[model samples]
Target: MNEPLIEKTSGWRGTRELWIQAAYGALLETGIDAVKVMPLAERMGLSRTSFYGHFSDRKDLLDALIQLWQSKNTGNLIRRTEAYAETITEAILNVFDLWLLPDLFDSRLEFAVRNWAHSDARLAAMLEEADIIRVEALQSMFERFGYDTVHASVRANTVYQTQIGYISMKKDGPSDPLAPRLERMRTYAEIFAGQPVTDAEAARFFARHPVNET
Candidate 1:
């Protein structure tokens, strides 16, 4: 059985966000090839003409997608990492929260963009630049925690590369359940932070970022 396309909101005449979101969702679920205007229009149950009102063309949409990735992933992450933390471990834990929490950062979107980059040289270059920005932010966090420049850089690379590797490697299995997976992530975070997050701290974080199972 096939699901029906989602209809547009009634009397909706606004900015380009809905269309952009549709494109992003398509890119995540399918690939760059699925990001064409007609398919997205079909999914949104909107006329093809509506997309033109928001974007000049497909290239415009792609450009918007790139901008969205930069602002959402890199910009938001740097801000989160730079937020107040009493210790280096806490600071790193703050950053780890973004990875663990889906609402903060979309790992599937990141993977989709990386897959898109494999075929486009210019996109690949842009992705590389974004990666540098992200790693530099993490390095700055380590430096703020009193690490020497060299060691901070190395630690930053370690954390960032571990995540990149995880996304890059494709696995097929009946995965371990969420609780165990999250526990393992906590262990990984503790290793990176050089100490376990206290129960109170972990509780506070969970309160703020309750997992969305829906």
Candidate 2:
């Protein structure tokens, strides 16, 4: 039986989060087409008693998924770019934290959404809007460092699109080792921010994100 999110007194229909999680799993594993409510209920071991007490329809679930993506992925990225930092490199490193923390930016969901957009004009438009919002946030970060609007736009596009491309190509692939990846981040910061990462700056980041190195 699907455990009720509430106490024993609650209904057995399962919480909205359960359905959304199952929908995300299905979308990531198979494709968007597999995210119907009945199959999700079956996968969740729920009774499938027309028990959609949360979302009214499959489209409702899908909208929930997209809203979650918007909040986690794009919302976090914007907040990162806006986070307090002493230098452009530090600012960019703040943005880079998303690459490490899936809680901040779920790359698998992002990839699936991008692929889904190919056949979804509405989603494709939303994607373009999201890209604009993301790049503009990066641009604003650059502007804080005294870059001209043109330079900021170019650099922001470079950083944002490069990461998007990386997500698309990195599907289901193991990431490169952390130590080497950390080393390359120094170079990446300089390239993206047009500023070198100081040893102190790099040390702060490395210390914050420790590698087991075992």
Candidate 3:
């Protein structure tokens, strides 16, 4: 008896989403070396022919994953920071907290990406552009808080770098839990903005700690 191939209803968008999700999952579980087209195709329960219909090669899949990441996380960060004009500082802190908290993505995924970036030019460029967008978003928030462009830019870079450093350090060795650090960063940001920190404000600081620790 011949079984029919069940057509996927997800169309191109669904197939692309599955590809990106699978790539991210594979990278997180086994690093970049494990993300070959054959393995990915197997994982997706699709034939090489079907996979080829979506991506030209492994590099193409990686490129698509990078675009998806930027579109979802980096793009949303920019939009949320801009849209929350009134509470710019709090909004910015919220964005940072999302990344810093546990269980969102294994911190190891970030570590792996950083190392992969060293050898892969395209990934490196994407990382650089993402950082620039983050800094720019922070600068805009600072300006809304009444800081001049120069000061705002500097502060933005400082905060942005501090986060990278914090994540890198956590990846390297022992450190405080992400929740406490996030709260501390929020308090510092409030003081940096020359505003009094309210308990309500501090409460938003530790809100997003994912319980499923990776």
Candidate 4:
């Protein structure tokens, strides 16, 4: 039947996407140590050469995957931040929330990437650049909220450090504890900014706009 044929075609497309998704998932679930080229090919039900058609080699694949993640996360952050750029406190909290989203930690890709960075200078440089981008984004939001340059930079770093600490704790301890910690973070931000958190505040902080043209 036509329906059966259509289903089969859709299945192939699904399979390819699944393979790509699995590659990232594997990296997150288990570090690069688990990423054997032959095994991944077999898992995808394809020959090793087929993978080469998609990527030149393992390193190539890794680079592509990192770029994909960076693009996705950066876009999401930019869109969300632009949507809500009103007050300093709201903007800071929005940044924190995006960084601490539950799905962000559900994978081991960050850990795997950190390990990869040790030997791969290129990867290390990319990670550093990503950090700078993130910090700058936060700083810009702070400036929109009326903070001076020095204070904005300092507060952004503080918030960033706190999020990193939370991630470290989630890895070392019970991740289920993150929600309460996030709440505490909000409380801390409120105290520091001397204002109550509000939905309008969050909305203004998350409002989207174009990146400034140089």
Q: Against the hidden reference, what TM-scores do the models get?
A: 0.85, 0.92, 0.73, 0.73
**CA lDDT of every candidate:** 0.79, 0.85, 0.67, 0.60
TM-score: model 4 vs. ground truth: 0.73
lDDT digits (tens) for residues 1-214 of candidate 1? 3242564576543359988888898898899999998788777777788888889999999999999888888888888879998877668778877776666776777888999999989999999999999999999999998889998898899999987777677321124245555566667767876678777666666666564577
Top-scoring candidate (TM-score): 2
State how far residue 192 of model 1 sits from its true place (Å). 1.9
- Candidate number with the higher lDDT (2 or 3): 2
Collision count of model 4: 13
Model 2 per-residue lDDT tens digits across residues 142-196:
9999999999999999988888888999932236577777787778999998778
Better of 2 and 4 by lDDT: 2
Those runs of model 2 whose alpha carbons end farther than 4 Å from true positions after fitting are 1-11, 171-175
Regions of candidate 1 where Cα sits further than 4 Å from its true position: 1-4, 8-15, 170-176, 195-200, 206-214
Worst 10 residues of 4 by lDDT: 1-10
lDDT (C-alpha) at residue 14 in model 1: 34
Best by lDDT: 2
Q: Which prediction has more favorable lDDT, 1 or 3?
A: 1
lDDT of 2: 0.85
Q: Taking the tens digit of each residue's C-alpha lDDT, what string does model 3 give over 141-177? A: 8888788999889888877686678567764222456
> If both were scored by lDDT, which would come out higher, candidate 1 or candidate 2?
2
